[model samples]
Target: MKITTLTNPRQTILLTSRAGNKDNVMTLDWHTPLSFEPMMYAVSIAKARYSLELVRSSKVFVVNFMSCQFEKEVLYCGRHSGKYIDKFKETSLEREEAETINCPRIKQALGYLECQVQEELEVGDHILFVARVSKAELREKGKRLFHLFADKFTTTEE
Candidate 1:
């Protein structure tokens, strides 16, 4: 295993966005908090991802924090393509309008951060979207899902 495997169990999120009337969601694990005062967050998406184009065109997205209960849905979203199939239609996941951004948030998510893209930088094979949190909320109490390497996942004990 790579040393970065030590970073295993990174928080798993469903990045939701909209292009015109079409809504899209994708499973993502490479994201982080950037600022505090303005409450910024960043997510790294590959250039070929359909959601990347949607995010670029819409300039906004919702980081829907999922829980362990939705691991199957998470894997489904990650393994499939929004260009070919409707993720929501294929999975049990439900969506709702974000508080600030004009995108959808996962209803089954433990929480969500509606963000507006502040900057986009080319980071090797991925585009890093730096965003300012326009709205944030915790829907309920649950242990967040974490991605560990490939098909493995874990969650907090409590």
Candidate 2:
């Protein structure tokens, strides 16, 4: 069985976090809503990823729902890394303070959920971070980007 086939054509999201002076955003496709009552959200990030380290130290992250307009920015963040460059500056994505967390959310996002880390576990090559949503914000609705496996991404409006 191919892992690519298993995780194909998934809705993508932007995961943001901050550690000290370092803030970063990364394209995430392995995320889901776990519960409604407690407003739980989970994201599976590779342990070796830079964003994972920031999230681990900060214990907070913002899940930004990007519109189709941000497909280029998403690919840039996913392709590069925060270790060598400032993603916010490089991508020119505006960062705004999260409601209940120290991290920042993408200002251009259609919606966002600010989360505080509740639990984490090492699952295979990735670390599953389950967080409780402390606050959320939604602006004018728009089409969202969905990764269609490989280098392909389509918009929700399509």
Candidate 3:
């Protein structure tokens, strides 16, 4: 077993970013709340990821906390790249304008955090974007998707 899988059952999210007319969404589990006073967050993206470029250039993103039912769509976004195809058009997920950031948010998300990038640090193979939660919304309540391993998942106990 890969050591990385030790961090199993992590809550997954869809990160949205837009640069110019291009909007992108990517599946992410590597995120954390940094501070409560300022409402800060951090998400690590691979250096080669297409979404990283969008978030970097735009300095904004939306963290879409997805429901467990959207696992298929989440996996699709993770497998494909926005550079080669339009993820929003391909998936059943609907794109909606975020309240604070320029990026779009998923209409089906349980909640979302509109973030404005405050800093970027290169961490090994990933770039960690530290952002301030400019706005947040809880659209719905449901079991959230959790990634255990490739093609394997779990959900919060209801």
Q: Which candidate is the best by TM-score?
A: 3
* Candidate 1 structure quality by residue, lDDT tens digits, 1-158: 67456776788899999999899999998999999989999999999999999999999999998889999999999999999998989999998888787998888888889999999999988999999999888878898898887889999986
Overlapping backbone residue pairs in candidate 2 total 0
Clashing pairs in 1: none
**lDDT (10s digit) by residue, model 3, range 72-111:** 9999999999999999999999999997767899999999
Report RMSD (Å) for each prediction in the order shown. 1.2, 1.2, 1.0
What is the alpha-carbon lDDT for the whole of candidate 1? 0.92
Error of 2 at 133 (Å): 0.2
In Å, residue 57's CA in model 3 sits off its true spot by: 0.3
- For model 3 the local lDDT of residue 42 reads 96
Instruction: Order the candidates by lDDT, highest first.
Output: 3, 1, 2
lDDT per model, in order? 0.92, 0.90, 0.93
Q: What residue runs in model 1 are displaced by over 4 Å at the alpha carbon?
A: 1-4
lDDT of 3 at 40: 99
Over 1-158, each residue of candidate 2 has an lDDT whose tens digit, in order, gives 76868776787899999999999999999999999988999999997899998999999999999888888899999988899999999986999998788988899998999999999999999999999999977887898888987679887653
As a whole number from 0 to 100, the lDDT of residue 1 in candidate 2 is: 78
